[model samples]
Every structure is written in C-alpha cells, then in structure tokens.
Target: MTAPETVVPTGKSGIYMPRRSLLMRIADMRAWLFLVVLIAFFEVWSRSAYGVSFILNTYNLQSISVFATAPLLLALGQTFVIISAGIDLSLGFVMGLASVIAAHVANYAALQLGLPPLAAMLVGMLTGIAMTIIPGLVNGWLIAHLKVPPFIGTLGMYGVARGAAYLFAGGMTISVSNSWYSTIGNGRVLGIPVLVILVAIACLIMHYLLSQTRFGQHTYAMGASQAAARRAGINVKKLTMKIYLLSGIMAGVAGVLYTGRFSAGAAQAGEPLLLDSIAAVVIGGASLFGGSGTILGTVAGALVIAVIQYGLVFINVEPFWQFIAVGTVIIISVLVDQTQRRFTGGRQVE
Candidate 1:
C-alpha cells in the first residue's frame, strides 16, 4: 500500500486552527455547560440563602429525585414525539385517566374478584396500559390517516382523556388497597427509591431505543423531512402511529407510578406535568422544530428543573415566583435553541 501524503493548511488557516478549535468545542458544549453552571449557581445560592447543610443534605437530594421521577418519565416520552416532529398535549391527562382506570380495576380485582394482591396489581397495570394505548392509537389514526395536525389531534385528545378521567372517578379519587401496588412507588431497592429506580431504567431503555435502533433513525428522518423519509422507503404512517403509541405507553407507566405513590388515582393527577415535561425536553437542547434530542440530555434537564424548584423552596421563595423562574428558564432555553438553529443553518444538532 502506498503511504498517505501528509496534508497541511498553507495560509492563515493554519494560524487560526488552534485558536478556533477551542472556541468551537465550547460552542458545541453550550447546553451541557449551561446546565452545569445553573446547578452550580443553585448550589451556591442555596448554601448562602439557607445554609451549607441545605445544599449538602442527602435528604434534599433524595427528595428532588422523588419529585423528578414523574416529570422525567413524561419528558422522556415527549422526546420521542417531538423528535418525530409531533407533539402530545394529552399525555398528562392520559396519565390521569390511566391511573384512575388502573386503580378502579385493581380495587375490583382485589375486593370483588378476591384476587391476591400481586395478581390484582398486575391486572390493574395491564388495564391501565391498554387504556392509554387506546388514546395513542386514536391520536395516531387521526394524525396519520385522517390528516389531522398533530397539535389539533393531541389537543382534542387532551380534553377527551381528562374528561374520561373525571367521569371514571366521579370527579373524585379512586383508592387502591393493594399494598403490593404501593410498593412499586414507595419501596426501596438497595436504599434507592423504587420510583427513582424506575426512572433510571426508563432512561436507559429510551437511550438505547433512540441511539441504537432503526426506529430511532427513522424518527430523526421523519422529523427532518417527512416527505423525504417516505421517499427513502420509511413507513412514515406506521412510524407515526408507533411513536404516539410509545408516548401513550409511557404516560400509562407514569399513571401507575402516581397511583402507587398516593395509593389513590385522582382525576387531576399529572396536570402540572404537561408544561414541566415540555420545559425539560426544551431545556435539554431538543428543538421544538424537532429531529434532535438525547435521553441523557433530557435527564440532565429534569435535574436542572428539579434543582431550581428545590432551591427556590429552600430559600423560601413563593410558589408563584418559582413558577416565574421556571417560565423564564424555559423562554431562555427556547431562545438558545433558536440561536443554535440559526447558526447551524436550521439543521438539528445531533
């Protein structure tokens, strides 16, 4: 084999390379840097405002993890939808609906059918999954077959699902007496909260699905250009349906967690999670315009939001002010995303 000749820049480029390289790397890492800086700022502020112990407290960190699990799961599912250039406004309500259905089913199985706790729990979970999947399928059909816009399709489902939740529970809470169901959310594994463990497992699975599968590749392709993806032999309709289905399934999982944690399924559960999940996804560097995101980034984003919320509460900030702070962060995140898109000629960052 012939030896390759060395090639070198011959002009001003050579002088510029070393200096520009560092700047380019920093620019590429802006999202991660922003998250780190935000966390550091919160830690410092918490120490100053409350006490060093507040910032260093293991209990507070654990509490943040607990609070973060629901939103984290919702955001993970939102990542899939948004990556495919779709949105799911109904997810929060779907979670509530699923929770109610699960709780009611579990209660009936345990009390009426005289089933064992584990068996009743399993039955409830399956029912919840199926309930959420129905909306997912309907949303998919509306968007893919009926040609409804994703936003309109999901928005309509939002109302439908929420209404169903209220109706199912008679605008009240459905309590489940099964201790085994509660264990799913409250029990610990090796000193870690089971809810946190579920979140970790979900992140790992989503990371694998998004980073290593042909489905993931198709998702990016579809988001980038649906027509082009179809031309390239991707099953755009089926893929769209599957994406929404997965989102619904995740919402169902969140419902199960909610029911387990509270020992009751309230019709209003997951209402706040809608915006929080979107904020997490956006803060994590996913463009609303779609086609780019990562599960790891989303997890970091959730932590950032959780830290801000926890820090605010620790410093005794009013809840309204905390909401404002979160809103501001979300706006800044969107601006940053837009700036990045502009700089990159509208191409999504991988």
Candidate 2:
C-alpha cells in the first residue's frame, strides 16, 4: 500500500497552533487573570491587616461583582469604537438616557398600555442607542465625508448628548414597579448575576466578530490605512457608520442594565461609567489609535480597572486615591499599547 502512504508532519501552515490571533484568544481570560491577581493581593493584604477571614468578608461576593458591572459594559462599548479609530464620549450621557427611558417606559401608564416588562426595559436602553447612532452618524459624516477630526466631532457629541439627557429627564429620576422588570436587573443565572452574564456573552460575540470575520478585517484595514482600504474596495464609509452605530448600541444596552440595577433613570445615571469604560479598553492593551485593540485586551483592561477600584476599597484605600491610581493606570496602559505598536510596526499587508 505504498508504505501505507506514510506522511510527513506539516510545518507552521499545517499546525493548528492557534486559531485566535495573539490578542483575540486571551482577551476575556486576560481580564479574569487580572482579577485573579487582584484577588490574591487582597487575600494577602487581608491576612496582614484584617486577617484572612476578615479579608474574605471584605472581598465578599457582592463587593467584587458589584464593582465590575459598569466597567465591563463600558469597556466593551469603547473597545469596538476605538478599534474603528473612533471614540464615543457621550456614552455616560447615553447611560443617563437609558436610566430615563427605562424608568419612563416602566411608568404604570406604559405598563397599562400593554407593554411587556421586557419591552419596558428595552425602552430605557433604546435611548443609549439613539444617542450613539445620532452622534455616530455625525462622527462618520465628519470623519468620512467632511473630514472633521474624530476627537473634536465625538467630543462635541459628548457635550450635546449630556445636554439632551438633562433635557429628557428635566433633572429627575424614574423607577419601575413591576416585579418582573426587577428580575432582569436583580436576578441570577447559575449563581452569576444576569448583568454579568450579559456582559460576558457580549465579550464573546465581539471577540469573535473582531477576530474571525471579514468586517473585522475591514475595520483594521480602515484604521491602519483608510486610503488602502478604499483601494481594496472595503467600503470604508459604510464601515465607519456601522461601527459608530454599534458603539451606540452597546452604550444603550449598558443603559438598560444600569436602569435595572439602580431601579431608576436619572440624568446622570451613567456618569461614573465613562471613566471605567475607557479605562478598561485602555487597560486591555488596545491602542486608541485604531487598528490595534483586541476584545480580549479590552476585557483585561476592564478587569484591571475593576480590580483597582475593588482593591482600593477592600484595602480601605482612600477613594480619591482610586481616581488618581486609575489615571495613572490609564497612562501606563496607553504607554504599553504604544510600545507594542512600535514593536509590531510594519506595513500591514492584509
């Protein structure tokens, strides 16, 4: 049988080394690893200062997860937009809108009108989406057509979205009375909070899209070289528009979660989320310059921020120091991103 068709081992081409690129494979796990390190540190600190059991009580289940929700959502949203070489500064405001919309929809009147509890919940989130789409459209038009600076364009939307948020709420908070409405925000699945589940799933979906799909390839292509992407017939403008839209959609989803968790929608519902969200993306080792961030990196970044915040609180570190510490982390994260980019510097052929 011709020696049973003895075959030679293939080279790198045949190696199933890793289907995931360097960044995609560990994006979420990296975030979790950061969490693990923080947990270890906290365990040590607690042993030294408060004793191990006290540490356990302080590093309690609720505390760890509570700090994570906002940052995780915000990071995911920021990751996609930044990869497209853009940013959405209005995310906090969209979160505020989410709070308002959810509360507004939760109104007994809307409930009486036959709106399902889930539909009511969605209404709150829809505002985040609108804010994203509107300014994303603006950002796209300016950057793609008008050639306006992405920084200035998105920054302007930030102010505008915040203003609209106040207008929508007239500076008030709203809440829902439906028990079912509360279930989503406050419920658990397999011992994991629903919000956590949602965020985790989103990470998976985004990571896959970024790593495996044609659109993702085009996204990097556009960021790396818009002209080249156009030359490659990548429909750069459409991609830009879609990317911004996705950013808005994420913010809106976060809004829904926020509304449910707080059981209220206020004009300022999502303010704190802004810092952690951007911080997470930065921490995850994604370049703000587009063409570089991986979803895995963003998740890591988010966890980093969450851990810092959690660590500070658990160790009784001053809250103000948390802010200062996070700012420092952001600088460090950016530096790391720059360094990796420099190391990888070459004309991106694909």
Candidate 3:
C-alpha cells in the first residue's frame, strides 16, 4: 500500500495531515451505495426481462415505500437498543399485541360506547401505544436490573407477547368497521401514503434523539462500554430501561400504523417483520456487537430491502428469495463490520 506523500506549503511546512482513502471515507455510506446498486440492477433486469421500467413506475416506488414503513419503524427503535449493545426480540410481537388491542379498543369505543369514529380511532391508537409499556418494563427490568442477557430477556418477552396477542384476538383477525380508520390506513396525502409520511416524521424525531441530544450521547457511551460509561457518571441501568422503552414505543407505533393501513388487526401482524427489522439495522452499518448506527443508514437499509422485495416480484422472482437476499446482505454487513473493527484496532467508529 502506498501512503500519500506529505506536501509542504511554500511558507508553512510544520503541518501536514494524512488524507483518507476514498474507500475509508465512504465506508459509512455503504448502505446507500448498496441501495443504489440494487436499484440500478433491478431497473436493468426489469427492462430486459419484463420490457418495463421497474424504478420509474409511480406505483412501484409507492409500493416500495409502503413496504418499507413497518420494518423501518421497527428498525428505528432497534437501532437504539443495538447501539446500546442490546437487542429486543419481543418488539415484533409487541407490535402484534398493539395491533390487536388497538383494533378491539377502537371497535368498542365506536360501536359500543357510541363515540365518534375519529375520536375512537385516536383513543385506540393511544391505548395501543400505551400497552407496549408493560413488555418494555419487563424486558428492561430483566436486562437492566437483573443482569439478564438482552437476547434471552427479550426472547422470553417475545413468547409472552405472542401468546397475549393471539389471546386478545381469539386466534383470528379483528377488522375495524370505522371508515375514518380505514382512510387513515389507506389514504394518501398529496400522492404520498399517510403511513409513509408519518414514518418520515418519526425518522426525523429518532434522528434527533440519536444524534443531537444528551440522552443520545449517554446511549453511545453505554454501548461503547458500560463500565466505562458508569465510571464516567453515566447511569447505565436507567439508560437501558429507557432504550427498551423507546423500542417498545417504536413497535407500538408501527402496530397502530399497521391497523390503519390494513383496517384489520392480526395477531401475527408483525411476525414476519422481525428479521427484516434486524436486517435493516445491520445493513444500515450498525455493528451487531453494538456501539454504532445511524437513522439515515437504517432508512437506506430498509429501502434496500423493500426494493429487493418489490423488485424481485416485479421481475418474476419467487417470494422466498427476499429472505435469502436480505440474509446475504446481513452477512456481508457483519463481515464488513468485523473488518472495520479490525482495522480500527477494536475502537468503535461512526
């Protein structure tokens, strides 16, 4: 390897800085690059194989964005947990629980209690979001207070949540009759999906929380090193609780949005999204071992998955390939993360 030669200035020769190679500089943006590459590949494939433009179609773009919303929302919260060196497997079912609960509550409020449709929908949304706190607290207590491993604690909660969701739904889907609710779920604003617009707003808020606040700073500190963060006067336990709680809320939000989009709440609403959520976080450049990730990267990762899913169908690929494709990306991400860590001598880099 050749290092850049130092160039001394005509008047000042004391200062010379090493310039980073192009690869190193763009390492953080790998997710975006992957997304671009996938889009280009799919566009070419569609043109040649199907005699149509894949990415240029309005319907295809909208469908991809909508497909991404659920996973992206789930991944947003997962981003925080993973950044703190933890995971929350329960979030997927926590979303299911919220969905079922939201649909039931909305029905009762509107039909039984004689509340207005719009108000009932709002009530249901709030209650559904609030219901996730129970599981969040449980996972937090186990991991933060009892010293249980995050994976185990969250996995346990995952079963509990799954069971509860099915129980609430009575082993079936609950459809909402309210027209207002349906509109919220399926409606578009200025040619954009309401769900997509809502998720975009959520992404902005999460980005602020993760990148601009003291809490975010503390989260990074904890993920990088719990003991070191504690020694530096950061409260690791409280932060852990907050992280899981935030994660639960993220899942809950996704669930409510699910209800709106589908006009029905299924106990398994988020069952298949677990892998996609994790994949988005990983492909977005977050290390599985923790301590690094970004909201923007996660957005790109989710878009990459969505495009692959939608594009594959557009070009006549089997549905099962989506899983394989996403898993491959995840493996590559981990390998890249490990290599980057090695290059950095084990220091966490953003």
Model 1, span 86-205: residue lDDT tens: 899999999999899999999999999999999999999889878898999999989999999999999999999999999999989998888899998688888788899988999999
Q: Whose lDDT is greatest here? A: 3
Off by over 4 Å in 1: 1-31, 348-350
- Clash tally, candidates in order: 0, 9, 1
Over 4 Å off, model 2:
1-36, 53-62, 108-119, 122-132, 344-350
Cα lDDT for residue 29, model 1?
Answer: 55
User: What would the per-residue lDDT of candidate 2 be over residues 154-181, giving only the tens digit for each residue?
Assistant: 7777787788777877777776675555
Candidate 2 lands at a TM-score of: 0.83
Clashing pairs in 3: 185-260
What is the RMSD of candidate 1?
Answer: 4.5
> What lDDT score goes with residue 239 in model 1?
92
Instruction: Candidate 3: list runs displaced more than 4 Å.
Output: 1-19, 348-350
Strongest candidate by TM-score = 3
Error of 2 at 146 (Å): 2.2
Clashes of 3: 1
Against the true structure, what is each candidate's TM-score? 0.90, 0.83, 0.93
Model 1 error, position 165 (Å): 0.6
lDDT (CA) per prediction: 0.85, 0.70, 0.91
